[model samples]
Target: MTTSTQIQRLAIVTGASTGIGRATAVRLAADGFHVLAGVRKRSDGDRIASSRIEPIILDVTNDEHIAALVERVAQDPAGRPLSVLVNNAGVAVNAPVEVLSLDDWRFQFDVSVFGQIALIRALLPTLLSTRGRVLNVTSVGGRVAMANFGAYSAAKFAMEAVSDSLRREVEPFGVAVVKITPGAVSTNLTESGLAAAARVTDTMTPEQRRRYAELSRAFIAQAEGFARDGVSPEHAAAVISKAVNARRPKTRYTIGRDGAMFTFMPRIVSDRLLDAMLRSQNKSLAQEKR
Candidate 1:
């Protein structure tokens, strides 16, 4: 028989196969919560190091998987209640709107917006039972849009609205909704985005391809350069852990120096000037090729 003492606080972290999701799950387990680490691949589950973590196969984009996860967490022994849900599973679709396909746009919102909201809805009962918190691991793009990131950033921006709305609604019931926006974190996201962008380029007409050339080149360079300069996933993970344990968590946590700058600077800076700066970045890439 399971005793009350044997039960532990639970945290469900999506995209636990890599980067911030993986780091957060590891850190939470270290901090004494039994983490439900959601990974899409069996091989990834094999890589988690903590005994307190149960690596569950979960793909946020799959409806059946989301339902099954809800059912699985609901079966936790009588005394164990879920304390947190980290919506971290996401894909980046990086391309200018002119070059972006309809399918790519749908996939971006499907994973980061619809799928995440569905999981949260399914898990809300379990969360309310424990008066738990919701942590959305978003990107710096969520706050300030940039060239070639419209699709991905749109989804994150939508998520920011969702986070705010949910935060207000859930707070009266003692549930907190927190958003963690990190900038240029060392992760597989950029590589994945670039891969998707390559496929988009392959499908483009000659004119569209030429039109997007400068933006694509600049995007690739920026992503690669940021990978070298970005903070580690551990930095984001630590903020998440702190948010999880705080008596009164803030509405958002900007995880790095770059994150804080990108998220807040847009509010004070003029839109026209920002657009000029971003356009200049693309021009600089074209100049490099000349």
Candidate 2:
């Protein structure tokens, strides 16, 4: 028989196969939440589940999957109002605006923007029923621009705007929208992003290629450095968990040292100065690749 303490809150976490999403799902399960881990692949879903975490096949890009997940959660015996919805599934495609293919641009926007919005729309009814919390996992890139990451930054910026609007709109309904931005957490995204950068640059004009090559390499190197310095996914999960449980959760939570610095520095520094600083970083990165 399951004890009251064992009676878990129901949470649906997208992108639970790896990185922050996986960590959040696991941590929530450990915290006595019956986690519905969402992954694109069945294999990844299976990998996400254990005695505590229950995996669910979810492809954010698929409408059927999102609808099916909502129905499944609604039918749970726990009938517990969906306590949390963590929108953590996202992809990064780093390329210069000129060189980036339309498909690549749309792909990033689809997963990070359209898909995320769709999931929230599908689940908003459940969240409203339970007066639950919605956590949008944004990135520090959303707040500031980075060369070679225009596509990713654009999507994130749009997501942040979406989150801000939703936060205000949902407050009266007692559903809180929280935005958590992490600077860099050791994850495969950097490696994959670098690989995509290489692929995109291959089709670029010689001058465009020459300009982006060093910049891209430097960007990758920086990403690698971030991965090395980044806190574990578990650490990010813990911080998120606290936000979920807090009596008065803040609208925004910035994770990691770099995240905090980038988030707050803008208030103290002039925009032009900040732009110069960022440009300088890019220039230095380019030089390093030479």
Candidate 3:
């Protein structure tokens, strides 16, 4: 396999600005892949350009950026086939269903689900030819909705559904689909998601605000704790590297201690028991009003 990589070992990683995506891109490059690291900001691209990675502007939600990426891959000097596509670009929303603005919900799905589908669609020809893999970087929330995380979980759940269907459909073609579910990955995503949720809180009516006050406060603290407890993004990147190189990778890889525990527990417990366990973990909601 090491010798075969010389044929066309190109890989594209979206959301390479920071976190797991950046780490994965760097790791793949170290493993001898011609990595195209995608970022939405010029500063991000500049930061990663120092490495062997070739950074490109890729806002996954934008059709134009997707098109540009396709063309860039198509024009590979070696005309090399894309060996892998890492759909790591995503946004998060923290509002409850009642007040989750329609736009917020749409925005969550826009990047995580719809944009990924579009990327796969445009890149399918290349992927099929190369018999490459598609790795969707999802969350533990995809398997089990977390408290106060309906908007983000909903998007990830949908991503899981499509990935399942896609795997079956493309397996015959030698194209693989794998989901990377990281639990509380120590990334800026937690901060950004909580901040976005705060904005949603501001837009609420006084009555609505009061209704959400307690749980929302708990939720914010919960997100912070999750971020603090998370393992380094490099650990998650290592798991992703394994997935890309495995002869027959598992359907999913869950990173972090919490990620592994959550994934395992869900399989053995009944749904009702799982709900009880989840609620037990939501002790933040039990804190007395301050």
Candidate 4:
């Protein structure tokens, strides 16, 4: 009989160019899984490739890339069973619902929601065969939608629902679906989000700008603060690793104190109270910029 030690395990992590995805890829490789690290550019793939971590070009929004990834998994030279799929590729485009273009909203959902689901559909067969785990790197935004974050938050909220539905659908089949909800981490998201926010602000009408410009700045400041005070990608990776390795993992795993708080805060607090709290915090952040 083949011992568990003798069987090689394969894990795939998307958006592995940097931050949490990169960290998780490295962590899983260290844990003895042969990792397929997904990156958008060839240079990035080259940068992250290792003996145990093979970098693959994967733009989650691209169907051809998705097909290629499925093929790669099917043709693993070592015949290892795929044990984990980390749906970590996501982009945040933050703007007021009225100000953000329909195209922008669709783009956010395209990468964060549809792309994630597409990959899962492609790999569900292999995952089912191996009784593998699916780890979705979602955000606290899913639970608490904040002002000026409607597009990004909506996508996360959708994924949260998807995660719940998927867990129920797959759990009985021996496939584990875990949501890795992170509040904030010192990643490039803040910088990218700020840039996107600036572009959106430029497109706003003068009336719209007058209404939301300061609020947008406040949101930007808050994002920067989150990045400055947030946990490291390695810490997020450790949390994710725990979820991946657990024999019977919880349906959801929150990464930080903020994650835990915001996730459950909605359950305990009334919407009116939550709104007041968010308003107060945004006001404080806006003042700090003065």
Candidate 5:
């Protein structure tokens, strides 16, 4: 028979204002878990809060907020271990390596890599005590890089590495670290990232722009297309919920068909073949424009 402890779980999800994070927060609450929906803004938090889900203002980049969250988790009356920590907060900046500014690159890293690490470190004590699970929401771009997504891919690659190392480090303590690589989901990230990309592109010298025009357009179009064809955030959230609740979850979970097929399949194929295939796809998109 399942005990009360087994039925009641506490889940903390970062970036819970919208998209995957928001969806996951709602789903976890519905699954009988008390959810701490972390958002950077109070308004965003307010939008996510409900009877089951409680909104908490958390900017992963802010040390003070992270510390507060740790304290709050430590004070839970049930003394039930934190069942899940879903690190779904990330930012994307799309631009060719040459045109991508240091600030833009840093911005992506700050949110996706450094911010995530900061939050994990701050909550390590509580997580260790509880033997909870940590889920890092990476991206397929981490495994396979596209031309214009260099900045974003670099951050995700670092996140993937961090997640893998953390998984090994905490295993002895009964804590599980899972890397969730999502391909494409309908979210504001693409539109916002594309705008940032455009700003970076505008700052490029005429010569640089001329040299990279086609690649730039192709990248923007790809981002837009992905946003359009992306799966629902709810679908992705369900996968995350499973990862948290499963008796024996895998080390890594890939969400979306493209992530499972194209992203994972390239690992088995030759690098040259993969490059050629990507080049062909981009070329086709360019030709369609002309």
Candidate 6:
């Protein structure tokens, strides 16, 4: 029989197969919570599992996976109460809105927007019972939409709104919702986004490619720089752990210098000014690459 003292706080972290998710899972475990690290593949699950971190096969977009996760929380073997849900699963499909296919757009929203909401809705009952918190890992693009990040930015912006709405709805009931926006954490996301962009470029017509090829190249170069100069997954994870453990956590947290700038600068700068600044930066980066 599980004793009351044996019960531990439980945290569910999606996208735990790599990067920020993996780091967050490890950090939370070290902080004494039993983390249910969600991964889509068994190999990934095996890779992240540890004494305090159990791996769960969870594709947030899948109804069955979400249901299984809810069931797992409901019947914890150690009677651990659900404490936090980290919605970190996301994909970046960077291509101009005019050139990106509807399928790609759907895929981006499916993973980032719909998937997060699906999991939240499925787990809300248990979370409400435990007065748990929800942490959404949004992006700087959410605040300042870029030239080629239409789909990704749109989804992140939607999540930002959802986080606000949910927070207001659940705050009176003791639940907190926090958003973590990272500037450019050193992760596999850049490589993945570039690959997706390449595919979209291939599908573009000659005229379309002629119009946007140089810009895409610049975007690629800048994205690479962002990854190279960004903070580590461990650093982002540490900040997340701090938020998780804070008695009165802030509604939003920015990970790096760029993260803080992009999050707050948009509030002060005019849209045209931001556009001009981004265009100049992109042009310089493109010229450098050439």
The lDDT ranking, best first, is 6, 4, 1, 2, 3, 5
Name the lDDT of candidate 6: 0.92
Steric clash count of candidate 6 = 0
Q: Which pairs, if any, clash in model 6?
A: none
**Model 4 residue-pair collision total:** 0
Per-candidate Cα RMSD to the true structure, in Å, reads 2.9, 2.1, 2.0, 2.1, 1.9, 2.5
Better of 3 and 6 by lDDT: 6
What 10-residue stretch in candidate 4 is worst by lDDT? 1-10
Poorest 10 consecutive residues by lDDT, candidate 3: 281-290
Candidate with the larger lDDT of 1 and 5: 1
Tell me the spans in candidate 6 whose CA falls farther than 4 Å from its real position.
1-7
Model 1 over residues 1-290: C-alpha lDDT tens digits? 22243237778999999999999998888777888999989999999946788999998878899888888887886456798999999999888888788898999999999989999998998888789999998888998899889999999999999999998888899899999999888888878887888888888899987878787788888887667778899988999988988879998899889899988889888999989987998788656555
Question: Which parts of model 2 are misplaced by more than 4 Å?
Answer: 1-6
TM-score of each: 0.94, 0.95, 0.93, 0.97, 0.95, 0.97
Q: List the residue pairs that clash in candidate 3.
A: none
Model 1: weakest 10-residue lDDT segment is: 1-10
Per residue, candidate 3 scores C-alpha lDDT tens digits across 1-290 of 34456335789999999999999998888777888999989999988985448999998889999999999999988767799999999998888788888998889989888999999999988999989999999888888886678988999999999899999999899999999999978888888887898899988889888887777767876777768788888988999999998989999998988788777777888989987776775554446324
What are the lDDT figures for the candidates, one per model? 0.87, 0.86, 0.86, 0.91, 0.86, 0.92
Please give the lDDT score at residue 236 for candidate 3: 87
* lDDT tens per residue, model 6, 1-290: 22233237899999999999999999988888899999989999998888989999998889999998889999999788999999999999999999999999999999999999999998888889999999999999899998999999999999999999999999899999999999989999888888999888989899998999679879988888978898999999999998998889999999999999999998899999999999998898888678
Name the TM-score of candidate 2: 0.95
